[model samples]
Target: MQQNEFAIWQEFDPHAKAWQTLNNDRSRNIARKLGIGDPSTARECLDCHADAIAPEMRGDRFQISDGVGCESCHGGSELWLNSHADSSVSHNDNLKNGMYPTDQPIARARLCLSCHMGTADRMITHRIMGAGHPRLSFELDTFTWLNPHYKIGEAWTKRKGEWNGVRDWAVGQGVAAENLLEVLTNKSAGWNGIFPELVLFDCHACHQSMSDRTWGPRQGTGLGPGVVRLNDSNILMFRHVLAPIDKAAAARILEQTRGLHRATTQSRDATFAAARRLHATIDGLLPTVAAFDYGPDSLDTILSSIEADADRGEYRDYAAAEQVAMAAQSVVVAFENDGKVDSEKAAQLRSRLDTLYATIKNEDSWSRQKFRAALAALRAAAP
Candidate 1:
């Protein structure tokens, strides 16, 4: 009741509206059907819906109805609450006192994906979706910026650290790739009885009508029609994310990605084994992604890599193409932020960006030809 009642207070009071997305009829009904409606028994629902922390971690003022309160993303208030407020304390000190480093790329990515994607402890398997839950998808930089609670101004940089939108986006892709791989390798999470979890695969692979004819070859996956390919949108985005910083690792990831996809068609054991190898590869590159400077050169390289994917029909799946759109946004924001693009060029690119968004605006009506044309125009417009 409070989230909606205090909706107007979100501007100055983010707690009023920022995280209260779960107190709805739909969510309640879904939880009720799944026998997790009551707060006492709704651990599964509360994992993402509310600040369902350990009893010991919660303070006196803590209430589950707050729905993803400060402590959910920040940390428990008992230790760092006063420390974070003290100007004398360094950011590192706050971290030492239990504040989550939400400012960092890899840390933020993993934390967000723990619920946005899922971990073994809070797995949103195909069974959950079967119970009327929505399909989950997340873009790190996009999601963060879409409903940003704080601005990355001069003071933020001084307090936290350097802020690179594209770099964070790249690291997010790598982390998301790792999360998916973890699921594949985890028997309890990825497999239900003898069947592999369908949620791990592309939704359009089976959701689309048989007559739609969207199935085409993805060179990286090397799969033919009628195969339920893993939703490798994050893996695909690595082409752009890593190529600019580490080409050899990028190529190795591509090879491993293909192997993982092929393994799915073979056997459960093969899929898990391939996913483990790919997971290790991504895990290795994470620190590199986190530390690398995503400057103008790196941003330009990522944009060109995205254009290449569109040209080669690498975006046959809706998921991969969706990431392309988010990447374009991240790159454009970075380019404009660093004064790489003049106003005139940005104005022209705005329409091209709109076209790209329009093409994928409706997943049911997504067109490969239209998206490619839009990407081409954006590429041509960029300096």
Candidate 2:
């Protein structure tokens, strides 16, 4: 959140060359071409790119150039700024005074997703994407690790309490699913005239060649040929997230998700109705996922469940394949971190990891058979 998101291209390595090349210099013309160019006039552009807050709330030192500043994720500083500095004030105290509790997984996911995935109030809409905005994809742990300013060691854990990459991944998927469902069900944000928002559907589904014929059956969607399936990557990942926690619930959500896809073939009303039910299912699971402990056994379950799906031809889409690879890596590393993976197993998993990564290296060249083979190998090698 520290980088100048508007003029920025990269987040800091604590010393990344973000200031040398501004994202604004790259985006300003596009915004101008789209007719929302000026930051002074275009609040939509500033909402995600810069620290666009109310004038009354801006501190004297606050500058828009800071991009996503402390207040952007931490909340409006008016109430907690001075108090947060005092050692006597507690984290809870800061939260009580309006500081955002980013330390908590669900809360942090919600905050990061507001811009990375987008919220109704601040959407990087399909219109924006069509006009050259990059396609937004986020995995909380993956994105968080991209710009590491600190280590999560003994001192960090003491100050922040328990932290787990698997827990973060699972909670992230649930929240991401919730966010998409929220947008999908919204009257204004979810719909563009008679059609559901195109962004909610898998880009690769329609973007691929007219003669590709790569489309295949996915139990999660049940979508047939020529169908622009809704992008339920997070939803599918969320089902795996629930597997070890609540197997029955996970099974139920998967069926509901398939129903959601089927509803799309019917009518807009049917689709939204199915989406609303699935949203409630995921919403209820978030609390349990956040608080649940993820041990070696649970991590193994996650890995295997993802593999089982892929093997069954349930993850044929490029986006879903991408998510599965990430989920496997997160779960395997979490197992290794907990000292559950032996050296030989770890080495094998790493080799398989390379294979898995190689399969999805190029979205345009994504092959269901190749990805499934890589995942099967990874699952076999995983501890």
Q: Residue 368 lDDT in model 2?
A: 75
Residue pairs that clash (backbone atoms under 3 angstroms), model 2:
6-24, 7-22, 7-23, 7-24, 8-23
Cα lDDT of model 1 by residue, 73-163, tens digit: 8877677776676778888998898888888888899999998989978988787787788888889998887755555677677887788
lDDT of 2 by residue, 243-353 (tens): 898999999998999999899899878978998999989888789999999887898788878878876787777888888888877887887899987888888888888
- The regions of model 1 sitting more than 4 angstroms off are 1-21, 32-35, 38-41
TM-score, structure 1 vs. true: 0.93
Local distance difference test scores for all models: 0.82, 0.80
lDDT value, residue 125 of candidate 2: 80
Q: List the candidates' TM-scores in order.
A: 0.93, 0.90
